[model samples]
Target: MINWKVRFKNRSWVMAFVAQLMIVAQMLLQGLNALGVTDFQLTDAVQQSILTFVNAVFILLSLMGIVQDPTTKGMSDSERAKTYKEPN
Candidate 1:
């Protein structure tokens, strides 16, 4: 079995995976609606809104990853000093 924690070690990877899942789910929902198995209404505006929200979430996750990266260190002095130190 695949361990999610090991496979998705970074927030960006996790967010991307989630975005893919959302895409698949949206497709499935649309298929179901076409087959008359669902009443889901994904109008252009609603679809655009959902896509925008997902993209925004991806951006936020990427920003969080950048903030916590060992390279960038941190935003403040105290954090920078601590981040530079070798982990024990």
Candidate 2:
């Protein structure tokens, strides 16, 4: 008795969750480097700034997924038949 729509929702949530997790990891690593725990081999300031910006973008995308309402992804007529057969 599993709904495919629910599964699709879970998939989106998992990807967003992983994206947010990576953001935290990247930010922490940058903070560590800022403290001089490790040297930034490639022009520290510039590269770190770029990496931070990319991570921020990823974080925003993830949050968008978390908050957005999902619309029916329009199933083909054949697939749509299955949905109609379900008890309303």
Candidate 3:
């Protein structure tokens, strides 16, 4: 089972959740427009921009999670230092 409390505590997770909600809202709007229930509509460029932004955000957050793995918690300062080399 998922731990909702801990998950919600992470800022990246919260942002991702909001992004997902935005996608859902877009879907609902599109559906309503298709059914002629609402005259309002988003342009193709606007929809594309929203999806691209969300995809980029998810990719960034995934990379951050990879960089923050739990294994680093057990590493000594010297060990951690050895893992990242100084730029030349």
Best-fitting candidate, measured by TM-score?
3
- What TM-score, over all chains together, does every model reach? 0.46, 0.45, 0.51
The CA lDDT at 77 in model 3 is 34
Cα lDDT of model 1 by residue, 11-42, tens digit: 65465677667767877987898899998687
Report the candidate with higher TM-score, 1 versus 3.
Answer: 3
Point out the worst 10-residue segment of candidate 2 by lDDT: 72-81
Q: Write the per-residue lDDT of candidate 3 for residues 1-88, one digit (tens) a residue.
A: 3345555666755776776677688789878999999998668899789778877876786677632335445433334344443311
Runs off by more than 4 Å, candidate 1: 1-3, 42-45, 48-88
In model 1, what are the clashing residue pairs, if there are any?
Answer: none
| Stretches of model 3 off by over 4 angstroms after superposition | 42-88
Task: List the lowest-lDDT window of 10 residues for candidate 1.
Answer: 79-88
Report the lDDT of model 3 for residue 42.
Answer: 67
**Residue-level lDDT for 73 in candidate 1:** 32
All-Cα superposition RMSD per candidate: 9.6, 9.3, 10.2
Lowest summed lDDT window (length 10), candidate 3? 79-88
lDDT of 2 at 31: 89
Ranking by TM-score: 3, 1, 2
